[model samples]
Target: MSVPHAKLPAWAEYGLIPLVNLAVAFLISGLVVLIVGESPLEAAYHMINGAFGRGEYIGFTLYYTTTFIFTGLAVAVAFHCGLFNIGGEGQAYIGGIGVALACLSFDRVLPWYLLFPIAVIGAAFFGALWAMIPGWLQAKRGSHIVITTIMFNFIAASLMNYLLNRVFKPLGSMSLETRTFETGGQLPKLDWLMSIFGLSVGNAPFNISFLLALLAAFGVWVLIWRTKLGYEMRTMGHSPAAARYAGIKEAKIIVITMMISGALAGMMALNPIMGEQFRMQLDFVQGAGFVGIAVALIGRSHPAGIIPAALLFGMLYQGGAEISFEMPSISRDMIVIIQGLVILFAGALEHMFRPAITRIIFGLSPKGRQAAATKGA
Candidate 1:
């Protein structure tokens, strides 16, 4: 007879395992630095200081964190529903069109506070609409969600290129972007929020969207844990056959979940478009959609976990830039390698240490000892 697999406690599964994985990733990253003839300690010092040394650094880090939080939550929502919504890149791209339309139509007439809500709805609606098509195909036509979503991403890119070049491009402007938004369209920076920490925001574009991202996280937690639909979603994710047996409508759940995921991804555009750039630009997403997949994996698809994971990635992005500037030997590509190592270890190889850790835990528990004795016999 085969021995049953051991299970980890919730705290160990969610918290301790991830921490150990991160530590190992950093340790390996240090080895890479050593091979490059630089002191790992020195590189680490610069990275930490660069990410948090000054208030402006924190602001920039949080600004990146804000975008990641949105995208991370998007991936997390879909993951919970047993769906991999890889079309976040496309959804966010199309969502920008919604935001731009709202701003272009109302920027001259409405104040920022008033336009913000309208823009939010517009963003979410367009993103949901974009994601809904793939969800429909998967639910109704038996198409593979992964292939459809990935293809939608490329389609979104092409669509945006055409729209930007032909429709949204202002006449006589050489740039392939829309006209810059006025004060009404621009989001207000959270200078007061920084002031509470006794630091100025400086040139960082950190804005109200960070607060919005937090709100979205809370909303997700409530939706996933506190609501009936969430229960159905979790059931479907755990076992579609059981869900169907329990009378849960898989088709409805898939579509709704994907729409919610897409909506979250779409809102990410608000940070860069309204919060910073004050205009939609090509490739403003900067791969946050793909980064979100790693974020969700590292976070274990929990809203609480995703917040810190997003912050960690934000640090990597900001600090990596600093590393490139401070140490010419470690170029931008080198920084990318460092980031990739972290993703490889933390995301892909996440369970590599689980069996060893499980054995250690089992060795320490009385019931586990008894079970082992029984298995051995």
Candidate 2:
């Protein structure tokens, strides 16, 4: 009861499969739009317009893309090490504390440039420390990484809630956030960059963090593809036993990988806190952590792929808001459903169409035909 299956080329494996899955997801989403008594094509037009019609919209879209890029790289890094670091939301949450402390301590004394690097270090350090516990447990105690990471997320949320409400809350302020950061602590907005190019974006929250995100992506590319540690991580992911046999230390790799992943997730705090909010606040992470899972899956866990994948999801988010505003029948929840569909197709059902693709490829290949003949015989 065995049949020969064709092997896809590298391009098809990395590029075409994801494209086909995305196309299928959009087609189904269009059907759902029809059921809601709306024109899918019109809805698509609105979404595109909302995300990129004006300078401000483009700015906002890139702003969201920046966060997604950080979080996506976080997840992708963990995936390469065969670890599921689902605690990115928690890591980002706690990273804010580092950002807050650094800003509060030096905001008045230090220049913006000096304070900025300190805050960045704080964020990465705290996030890495938070993730280290779970990573240690998984490596030394044989605990499941997914379960431990998920538990850490809840712990982080409760910890943040207590800190923000009891310790950081300013007098006479009912909000669950720290006082606004001093001028030196705040990041410079990208409005100047826009103005320099004769493009006005009307106070969009996009800032220097966007450039940092791009830099991070490039850094990850170098780390994952051009370094010895990256080779070990990928080897362990493929076969832990093989890695051990090859003299790679599994425990050390696991911990180091998670720390790096946590650091990336922690950096996401810079965008909302320093760049936009200018203060530490609850729920700042929103759901970018979870969305990162889908991004990593769809991007095939590569930095080059992650950048565009992050941009695509950013479009969906910015455009989804616009669609809900313009169409009476389409609620924000409907947009959520569409996003869920994309996740489903790209992640859970990714291989659903592979068998058919294999069949077609097999019919056209000599090696596959030889294998098929052997099977038939």
Candidate number achieving the greatest TM-score relative to the actual structure = 1
List, residue by residue over 1-377, the lDDT tens digit for candidate 2. Answer: 24334456678789989998989988999999999999999999989999888788888888889999999999999999889899988988888888999998998999888998899899999989888899999999999999999999999999999999899999889999999998988998788777776777776788898898999999998999999999999998988999999999999999999999999999999999999989998889988888788789889999989999999888888888899899978876765676678789988999888878766766788887776556545
Q: After superposition, how far is residue 290 of candidate 2 from its true place, in Å?
A: 0.5
- What is the overall TM-score of model 2 with all chains considered together? 0.93
Per-residue lDDT of model 1, residues 1-377, tens digit only: 25345567788889889989888888888888899898888888888888898989999999999998999999999988899988988898899988999999999999999999999999999999999999999999999999999999999999998998998889998888999999889999999999999999899999999999999999999999999998899998988999999999999999999999999999999999999999988878878888787788788889999999999988888787788789878765654565577678877888789878878877898997776566545
Clashes of 2: 0
Clashes of each: 0, 0
The lowest-lDDT stretch of 10 consecutive residues in candidate 1 is 1-10
Compared with the true structure, all predictions reach lDDT values of 0.89, 0.88
What is residue 251's positional error in candidate 2, in angstroms?
Answer: 0.9
Taking all chains together, the TM-score of candidate 1 against the true structure is 0.94
